[model samples]
Target chain A: MPKRYVSIWFRYLATDLHSLCQPQLKSIPFVLRSPSHGRMLITSSNAIAESKGVCQGMVLADARAIIPELQVLDDRPDLKEKLLTKLAEWCICFSPIVAIDLPDGLLLDASGCTHLWGGDQNYVNDIGKKLHARGYDAKVVIADTIGVAWGTARFNRKYQVVSTNDHLSILQTLPPEALRLENETVERLHKLGLHKIQQIIKAPRASLRRRFGQDIITKLNRAIGTEIETIVPIMPVEPYQERLPCIEPIATRVGIEIVLEELLKTLCGRLTNEQLGLRTSILKCYRIDGKIEQVDIVTSRPSHNIKHLFQLFELKLQNIDPGLGIELFLLEAPRVEDHLPSQEKMWEGSVGLEDVRLAELLDRLGNKIGTQSIHRYLPDEHYWPERSVKLANSLQEKPIISWRVDEPRPVQLLHTPEPIEVTAPIPDYPPMLFIYKGKEHRIVHADGPERIEQEWWLQQGQHRDYYRVEDEEGNRYWLFRLGHYHDKSYKWFLHGFFA
Target chain B: MVVSKADIFKGLQTDLLRLQGLKSVNNCELNNFLGPIASAFPNHSFPLGVIHELISHRQEEVAATSGFVTVLLSMIMGASGTSIWISASRNVFPIALKAFGVDPDRFIFIDLKKEKDVVWAMDEALKCGAVSAVVGEIGEIDFKTSRRLQLGVEHSGVTGFIVRKASRNIGTIASVSRWKISSLPSEKSDRLPGIGFPKWKVELSKIRNGKPGTWDVKWFDGKFFPTHVPIDTLVASDQWHKKKTG
Candidate 1:
């Protein structure tokens, strides 16, 4: 199958955008000007200004002399690039591969996309009509190669769909500049009486290469389909992606759910055959109004279960707003991992973390609330209470070392210790009484000054003298004193509560 | 003839308890772990596949209740079964669970910011039959939500525990039993100078169709040891013995 490409050239991109924002500027002749070589030069002009004497590359003062009532607006440095990028993203509704042909044009790989709109002619016409309705004077052309489409969209009077077999016939009539050569090279060809491409096409290859360098031959070969050309798309197509194009715009929740179910079934089917599972997926809904609404879901582990994946996506479907209605739905899985199918067992028993149902339940919960809130901890080799446990990276991660149960640890450890007022016998003895949160507790049974020194390699802090003390009411509290009892500024804090 | 009449009455009572979705204690292997507390539950068995409400008003009580619940979880999950703990603000240290004979890695901890999410996560976890138990820490729960959780566990056979923290009003809920646990001063049997194993005053405030009593229990060597039988439970057991032998 031959590949087809489309190029859209915005003739008055800057002026047209200005006119769209300020509707009153539509009737008047205006030119956008920018500072160049210490002088204001006209960068772009509206159709009305071009119909008059004002044109691009003219000095602002000279343009004003021609049309005294011409309105001049400041031209932003990156406005053209920004507008082209936005237009290219919008063109994704037409084709998946859209690239910005810098300055004023967009290139699209319309290989198999044109059949959706009937044919190449109707596809180009639809794009041109939609762009015209948006207040942009866009010239669109479709051809067998990007070079021919790009040159024809800019220089041709009307949109044309050049057939695959008529590449040289089309290039022969156009001027030598149609090959996309440098301006200096085009001028040299013209000085040599080679104004038409037909004359250049018939010239000897060695002489042409000697005169114009190898760039012309490479460009010519690319244009005639003798060499291949690749485009860098704005959004790279995902390896595991499914697309659903709606014949009629859909707006209801049920309609969206049906589309999501179809996409999931297709994507999951492919993953199952390859023994792969999706970890994260994104669903993009292209609205008829040219705005894309997207929702994404992440799984705790790799999964290819369609029902489970759909349930996770269903939790986040409310975030999508179908203004006007959506015409296209695309699901792309960005992260995937190898998944080995679990063998069926004869009897039901404990499966632990390897259970697929548990992963699905966690995925549903994580999608509803957040993934960060769900955690499984493994023991770390540290004495500090906060540093004793570390978050497990995944469900399959195992504890390298067993938990330290030799020493006494509190049932509930406070994130930050609360200060307490204590009365003690001094010299590292446990407190006799302590007041915390405006309440007084008389200690009856007291334990040790288990000194835990701070690891200096990780941080610097005073050693804590911990005591497991029971109050008169039988409520046990873990209290700690900072530094030594003889220190001038020694203080006590209630660190935790023991069961 | 008199023995047959008593046996028939006991059989009818067991059937009635079974009608109310309480499995008989004869079928459960966990009866020995709870000791005499198992007799306080319907059918003289520790209830499974039902919601249990644990109330705590202070930080100390919360810790005690957490310890008691972790002991039950260790028994329920056994060695390889998994569990989930959902809380708004988690204060339970994971490492401490090892002291209760539970592998910390086997328990998934979900720390949410809202009580609503905690309850929702607990409900989801309960519906998942792969886990043995689900524990949730929240401020309050009403009858409707608790009933939904009860319905979820009835089918999945997963036990649920909701720890109500700092709740001022104990509202009506659909839980099968309600408990309140507070720390008790450890007894130094060896005349040691330091504190001993954790002791808790376990109070069964409510049970659907069984006796509610308080008992003193202590945890050491990775098991619950009944320190002593309170007078109330002793009398109840005496009556139960009389009914069986008289």
Candidate 2:
């Protein structure tokens, strides 16, 4: 049976965050050393460097003598792990099943998706091209077995393929070492006058299995295509997706609208069929050049209505450019879940109309203004005014309610409390006359000091005394002073105002 | 008889009951905020729906960030959800908000890189819906942008508070309400030179239905509770509401 496998290799430069983050040092000759700058662990990519007179496990002093220009970097496994994780996230665009082959490699199961971009060869070429364009030297090889592909991509490039019937013919031309056998085993084979893989192929299978153990022969046979290898492809996740392949390339707005209507119909059909709805749907204009432009619409609730979906698409599609004419349209439901349809008692009654209209309006406004420019607030458990509120996107779930200070609270809240010099009656009392924002204010009347303690777990926690004071003009303000300002001037701030 | 398209359609309808047989039910109005504020808003506490304008604003001052913080703190103390503050401004004062009864552990502050970052954080926070409200500082706001935010709030029913340092007269944008706040006077003590009982000249610049004018208010103790603030009155408390509090 035809099967698939992946080969992974890594290129690493030992350096702390500076060198690791710097794009220029990726190509430089470097070694990762321990914090003491002691022993150097030559990276896997240094095989070429080793052949050029460099050696692994060499002292820094000796290596410096061999290559005066060799750059030194501190090994940071933590940083490398972070970088690998980020790279894996970026790979989600290509394949869903991305496994970390660690220290710097990723194994992507691209078997099924190979046809999406033409074929396996083309897919590997595209991946290599993308990685190379991004300033990385990458190598890729695909074969029936993982062991063969791994060995071929790393060691023997020319003999990458081994046909089933021709495995004997191809196996003989390569050296016995190409099989990634132990150095001791190869040395023994050479002493036995078995320098070439063909010599081993001709040897009696019973003797080879008995001498080297059955594991060796089984691995060898698998690499030579005598046995089958299984590959696990990453399955596509169900994010609401809708596609419209146009009969003709659509360029005009009317043509786009027609396509959008048809696409909405399909999307709604899928939603109904799947018994699911979407809080958000991203409409993709898949151009012929394989470029995709997206416009996302958020709904208050999961909906499966064709007309409502069309209205949102209409607003979102207005800004999309059908450049060079759009041949295909794809709508992906990025967020979808099960939704219980509301049963209307009356046929003429508007069923979930308000929520739908609100969602459509939000979608329209999001398109017109900008997706990031607008936000709603959610509550966070923090006393700091700046950290108390959170930004929310409307597409997911609605926050239940806004935070309300039941007791007396400030009408105007300052982002940051600036220190004000005050000559108060006492250190604990509110300032009688204070200079704030370059202006001086006289205290006509005042209130109590609401003591708020800092969270000890935090590093810069402090104790504060907050007061709500009224000036002669009846303007309200929230003011506080940091406790225990021994040396520096006491820090006072105007926090908020009353409504 | 051989079935035509019309005959097939008729046959399909034989088992289908008329939709007219279904009885109509009244739409239940979505209840938004609870407690006294459940009725404070004309639309019942700004139901979790998108509004063109959130966090009513009348003036654009870099100093107004404190005002934004107070609104956020109030929501957190009174509402059912969590609170988060995404501050891209260098002027973020965490100490002051702590004094306003906001739970210190509940607040999460994310320092973003750019002005656009505040908006991005806001979008993510709004989508989470785990929090009750969000507050962010923006330099300027346009109609279309406010519309988008309003839609976002409406969709999730999360209230949003935007603090813009400067204003360029965005005439008649949609907002539940708008208010202009400035520092008033604080109380005095013989030992201290600074004021107490922070007062504010709060002008309701724009409200959905309420009057649009200025009201002299005081942040007494810690709340925005009504107080006898005689700012324009010629007489002091000796002649004014002193009769009541006294």
Candidate 3:
């Protein structure tokens, strides 16, 4: 099969961008200038400035002399590359493979994509019209090869599609510069009176190589379809992505659900075949009003179950507005992991975190109430009560060490200890009575003075003397004293309550 | 040979209990854990796969209730299964579950910001057959929401416990039982200097087709031990301590 390519040449890219940002700049003659070799040079000019004899590469002073009232704007060094890359991304609706052809153009590998828009002619015309609508003056051309398409879009008067059989005939009529050769090589050819590409192609290959080197011949061969060219698409194609274009805009909730189920079925089927699962996925709805609404879902573990994935997405379907109806739907799985098929168990009741149903339930819960709310704790080797436990990263994580059960820890621990007024016999003794929140509790039974020094490696602070006390009402409290008992500024805090 | 009046009355009471949807004691695993408390239940066995409400008005009572519920979860989950604990603001120390013979890693904690989200997560967890139990700490729950949770557990067979903390209103709910647990002074053996093992006054305030009773129980050796003593003896001890201190 013959390869087809489309080249989009932005004739006035920089000036058009400036005009689009400021509408008043559209009717005036302006030029974008940047410093080069300590002198300001015109990098690009609007059509009005070019018509008035102010062209790129001219000194700013010279251009001003030609048109005194020319509007001068500072040009960013990477403006052209940024603009072309953005345009290439926007051109993804036409073809999935679009690459930036440096300086002022984009090249799209439109081999199998033109048929979607009816034909190559309509495809090229559609790109030009859309770009014009966006206030960019672009000349789009489609041909059998990239070189031919690029040359015709920039140098030719008419932007037309060239048939596969007429590649050599079209090259024969174009100037030698259309072959995308160095300026010196084109100048040498012009001095030798070889004006058209026909003369260069008829010349002996060895002699042309000796005189002009191999660059011209290589570029010439690429244009005539004897050599192959590949494009690096701006957006890498996702391995697990499905697209559904609607003939009529869909607005109903049922329609969206149908689309989601269809996409999920196809995606999960592919994943199941390869023994893989998706951990995260995003659904993008392209509305008719030129806005995109997106919702994403994440699973606790890798999953390829169609029903489970559909249910996870269903919880978020209400977030999508579908304003003015949606015209296209795209589902992409950006993160996937290798998932082995679960073996069939002999017993019917499989109760554990490893159960697939459990993971599905957790995924639904996590999605509904932010994923941060769900946590599993594992013991950490720290003496401080607050540092005794840490959150588990994954469901399958096991604790490395057993919990410290020898000490009598409180069942309920406060995030921060509350200050309490204690009346005690000083010098390492439990409080006889403590007042908390305007209530007084008389300690009938007390244990105490279990001094725990601060972990100097982690922080610097006063050591705590803890005590377990039982009040008159049989309520047990864990209290702590900061600093030494002899210190004049000792303070008491109620940390926790025992069961 | 005719049946006596007492035997006839006993048979009629059993029939009435059975008609109230309470099954007889058939599972021996729960018989020893509840001990005398099991007799207060209609079937003389602790019910499984149903919602139980635990009410607490004080912060200390909440701790005692949490400990009691955790012990029940440990028994229900056994050694391999997992459970979920949902609350709006969680304060239960995860390591404390290990003291009750439960592996702390086997439970998942969900701390949400709204009561509605807590109830929703509890319902979802109850409907999941993979989990053995779900514990939710919520402030209030209406009859409709409790019925929905009961329905969820009916199919999945996952037990549920709702710990109501600082609840202002005590409305009727559709749970199988309502319990109130408060801390009780532990018995000191021979004038021990330190506090003893956690003791709680377990009260069954409401039970469908069952007796309502209170018992003093202590947790030691990873199980419940009934420490039933008369209230008069406790008051008498209190007076003696006051006299000595005075």
On DockQ, the leading prediction is 3
> TM-score per model for chain B alone?
0.88, 0.63, 0.84
Q: Which residue runs does candidate 3 get wrong by more than 4 Å? A: A1-238, B1-26, B228-246
lDDT per residue for candidate 2 within A239-283, as digits (tens), equals 566677887777788988887777778788888888888777877
Residue-level lDDT tens digits of model 1 in A192-212 = 898888898788989989989
> What is candidate 3's lDDT per residue for A1-499, written digit by digit as tens?
6689999999899999999999999999999999999999999999999999999999999999989999999999899998888888889899988999988999999989988999988988899999999999999989998888988888887658887777778878888888888899999999999998889889998999999998987988888878887888897444799999999999999999999999998999999998999999999999999999999999988899999999999999999999889999999999999999988888868788777788899899999998898999999998888888999998889999988887888899999999999999767878899999999999988887778888899989998889999998889999999998776878899999999
Q: Which stretches in model 1 have alpha-carbon errors above 4 Å?
A: A1-238, B25-29, B229-246
TM per candidate: 0.68, 0.45, 0.68
Better of 1 and 2 by DockQ: 1
The DockQ value obtained for model 3 is: 0.60
Query: Which digits, one per residue and each the tens of the lDDT, describe model 2 over residues B85-189?
Result: 665653444334545555433444555557766665666556544455666666665667666666666546556666555555645555556655565444334
Clashes per model (N, Cα, C within 3 A): 0, 117, 0
Clashes of 3: 0
| Higher-ranked by DockQ: 1 or 3 | 3
Candidate scoring better on lDDT of 2 and 3: 3
Worst ten in a row by lDDT for model 3 chain A: A230-239
- The window of 10 residues in a row where model 1 chain A has the poorest summed lDDT is A151-160
For candidate 1, what is the TM-score? 0.68
Candidates in order have lDDT scores of 0.89, 0.57, 0.89
